[model samples]
Target: MKTVILVALLLLLFPIPVLGGESGLVISSYSVNPSTLFPGDTGKLVVTVTNTGTRSAEIREAVLYGNGLKVLSPGYSKLGTLTSGGSVDLTFVISGMKEGVYYPTLVVRGNDSTLQYPILVTVDSTEPEVLLDTGILYVNEVNRINFTIINPRSGDLTSIKVRPIVDGNVYPEYLYFDRISGGSSAKGVFYLYTTKPVETVQFSLQFNNGENVRYTNTTAPINSLPSREIQISLEKYPNEVLRYDTVVFSGNITNLRQDTIYSLIMSIEGDGIVSSRDVVLPALSSMDSVPFTIRVTPISSGTKHLTLTYMYSDVLGKIYTGSTDLYIQVPDKDVLSLNGVEIKKDGIELNIIGDVSNLGNYEVKGVTVSVLASDSEESYFIGALAPSDFNSFDINIPVKENTSTITISIQFVTGVGQLITIQQNLPVKEKPVLKEPEIPKKYYILIGLISVLVLVVVGYSWKRAMQ
Candidate 1:
């Protein structure tokens, strides 16, 4: 009875082999050649079928079906027989229509059994399209290379590197983008300078597709123009100014091109002067000109330099910056002066005659003149004088012995009503003495008495002779 029970347990555990072919068919393994496909990208799906049972399996046909996936080749693979523990590979070339996850089914029909399996496929379909927006690139200067990257599909791109390569070295050679979603765009810039000229350059785009890296290159021609495109000229009123005087600065801005410039902005800056200021302009058309003016007062005397910066953009979103310089000279302030002077000298006396005039653009009031000689001083009063007008003045100065020079000071109030003193030096010379015949102090009285006596004698002698 124990032996019978052991036989029955063995029979239950392991079933006896069938007389006809005992077969089993299963999908052992499947793989995607590239594992991922971009939209319109072609790839292959490989399915491996195996007979796992003890007998051989005959496969009549196998078919793959999915949505948005077009099979390049015939959709089925035929296999005559699959031996026991043997595997067969079925390849299906397919192209993806758009980006998304897809689940494909693989059905295998055999003589003994039928099997259905699910296959996983991913269509990345996200491609990066890079473009250069800058039109000109100059050497030995900070030239901006503007670029844009666009993702056109519905999938996301990751680990993107945009690199600019040229004949010479480029500053900030590359830019990185961690992740870019579908239907999105990003902008970047690279600054480059070269000692020599370069004609062409290449920009490379690198990004990750699943587990692989992809590279794409684009070539562009460099078209550089002169940096100073806008014509600017500065005009200063009273080009030569005096210290502490207010001056007017004027200028004109003209467009030198035949195209329209948008968002035109200008700024003014100077050294040792006021802070920066900006000028607003709406637009600039071809051959257009605009005038501007500013007033400034200088405390010290010297040359002043001004810089005008112009920033504008073109229709294609290209930016251009240019600059121009202006110079102004400042002179020292002038004092009141005397013109058309005449001097006459006599014995211990001097005469001075001159015209007092205002040469500058200022009024002078309370005018007075003083003469100092031999430590003695004298003053003369004159009235107010207007600009470009003159007045005459005369003065008699007394000089002492050994006095060779005299000082003349003129006092007045300036245009701004400020007290001022102006002075001039006048030379002095003494008149020489003349020598005459010497005569006694009483000679005129003695001569008169002699003449009277002679007259009486003559009359008495005449009377005696008549008697």
Candidate 2:
């Protein structure tokens, strides 16, 4: 006592490519929800009715009409039976008043059998797209913007977020994405810095399609352009620093851009610095310059403060950093002077040779040359002396006896590293006095025959002292 099958939804100008006749109940699958629709959007048009053969099928009512797709879900007096191979599903709420494709139909009348089906609905308005993947954009430095998040519309799109408005200055207000699979595209990065002039750079796009909720507003235009400089040059550092000297800071690192530059790095920091060496470059072409050296030894003296940091990348990789500054003048350990001291004597020992010149312009490391006789002390090691360069040391020492003078020390190490020693006082040479051997002419003829026999015995004693 329950049988009502009056389903209809005809509107297919030239549809019917597959309609069932023997009535085993057909109309297998059909769907159209948020698949697409935007003129008045509000969708749902599902239909699935299958009975096949060998059986029970008695659907009483189901109706849906179509024009621009307006069927507002009404008829359904009694959509009840469908057993044998069984299946039944019919819903229709669709409302998208015009924009494009629409072909709805789904008739199902049992017993006399008449199951026709056809479903396809789409009413797009198309949105979602934001361009500008960086080519040039800079006014007051720092600008590597890139935004391209397109989902032109076909279906998938949800949660995806993007925000960047650079008049108030933005660097990453928000940029999230969980899904974006319609036509597809994704990439967003920002790091803007504008001090005065700015024309455009705003992009705000929100998403979600199935439940309907979307927004899009994009703008990418700015032609102020004037920010490109990465040419550090320290002039080979060395102005004048003698006291406790040990300062070096070399230069050259120009890569003025024409593209090609990635992962370049350079470092040097100071504040009483005593060691350093860092420089790596993975790539760098176009304008290339490279060459940097730093060797310090400052326990913080006077006006010293150094810094030279750097980072690079460009060619879609983005990142680009900078830093440069150095000021030096450490005066306090230079008063050493005792050039070319020489003292050679070899037997009682006492050599003390010389030559340890650097004359100041830079380079001077551990130049030694000691000597202190008697209580004994000898040394010589002059290493790394280059500026006018000169190295030579001899030291021997070993000649005592109240040891006159002879100190001679002379240690050096200045370049900001101070360790100087200078002493001088030499004198210790006196040992030569012995002259007695100048009477050899046969002893001068035997002293002249003993003076003529003492004058013949004094002339006979003067003739007998007068008788």
Candidate 3:
């Protein structure tokens, strides 16, 4: 008895182990469509049965039974034989009648054994999400609104479609997407034309849970902005321009509206004699200002017409253009003139002296005068002559006896830094010819004869007066 008791205790402590073969027709993987369900909504439950054993297994029936989650399809029967390491799919249609959580049992019966597995199913009646974003919409033009449909379930959604519900104008009334994985999101887009003070925009999304069709909607407010005029003024510009006056038309371009300006450009086209180049400022934000300058050079004198043109576009793809006209009168007067000119001949040289005056309204820099005589050339420098100002210049150039005309050139730099030279021909003065004191050729004898005659007449008149 003691030996049997010891053997029993020993056997209880360390029992003998029995090893068997691997399992066949196991429930390898299972999934419920739209893993979360809604009341009265139908879905699917797919179970993958694999033959992981050394030999094939014959599947007799694959069925599902539960109290809360209702099964609409009958059991899968006579599924044939599954080869070793091969697999087959078992699908069942299921639904929920009320909002609650349910545990359903999957019973797989094979020729060798029977197995039962419980799957947790949910029926919370939670709806999917539809998000709408109207990103930077402009008034009275084509705009885009984005829609993001999110699936909060554990299974994927199918045949998803979104519709933009707007009472106003829009294109392609609806947008379609094929599918959205469970717990993931999908995107959709719609183009709409909106006006200022836009109305509320709404959206509706419809999809399938592999069994029944479901819907989700949203009512989002649509926002839009209007275009305000850009402020432009000629802040620092000359009202009149000289023949070669390079005047800068500087102004401040301000964005008074609530949107950024795009591709802003200012131009002064080549209008006959008035010419300029283009100035550009790509973008300007709201309430921001940018200063610009355009250099103008006029080549001719007239009632010249110029325009300071500006152009830009908005986010709505509409181009806005404006112009500020400028009228400048260029007088037909010589820029430099000579005053108080005097010429004299001294021996074999000619002296030329004058005051060089700037007649235009602009200053002339680096002024000089040159004289070309018959036998020689001369030059004088009179630097930096302001408008209506004068400077003296004198030149002594060698000349021949027969020299009659001489050339005078006035050279200077314009206010805009241009070298200019003007030439004029002047007649040289000749020396006065003098004869040795006029010999009274018989003139002295005739004067003595006149004096004798006057004396005789005076003697006769005196004798008569004495008598």
Best by lDDT: 3
Error in Å for residue 391 of model 2: 18
Alpha-carbon local distance difference test for all models: 0.69, 0.69, 0.75
Instruction: TM-score each candidate.
Output: 0.42, 0.38, 0.56
- Number of clashing residue pairs, candidate 3: 0
lDDT of 3 by residue, 1-467 (tens): 45644653453344221113244656677777767777888878887777777787788888899757889999988888889989888898889989877767788777767766666677866666777655455564446677677877766778877788775566677778888887899877777755555656777878887667888777776566764568887765666666655566778889876567789988876454544457788888878998877766566678778877888876655677988778777766457888887888887788999999886666778999999888578999999998879999989988887888888888887755667787888887775688678867598889889899899999999989999
What candidate 2 gets wrong by more than 4 Å, as runs, is 1-31, 38-45, 48-122, 131-219, 222-225, 228-238, 241-293, 296-336, 339-365, 370-467
Please write out the lDDT profile of model 2 over residues 1-467, one tens digit for every residue. 01111122332233232244443676666667677877777777777667776767777765665755788777565677778788777888887866877666566665555555656777888887788878576555556677788888887777878888776456667888888887888887877666566777777778766666677788877666665556878766675555445666777787765445778888877776553557778887767888877666555447777777888866555677888777777665443345676776656777767776665566767777788777788888877677766777777778864577778777877665567676677887655558885788987788887777788778767867754
lDDT of prediction 2: 0.69
How many angstroms is residue 295 displaced in model 3 relative to the true structure, after the best TM-score fit?
2.3
Model 1 spans with C-alpha error above 4 angstroms: 1-115, 118-127, 137-144, 152-154, 166-173, 182-184, 191-201, 229-232, 236-336, 340-402, 408-424, 428-467
Poorest 10 consecutive residues of model 1 by lDDT? 12-21
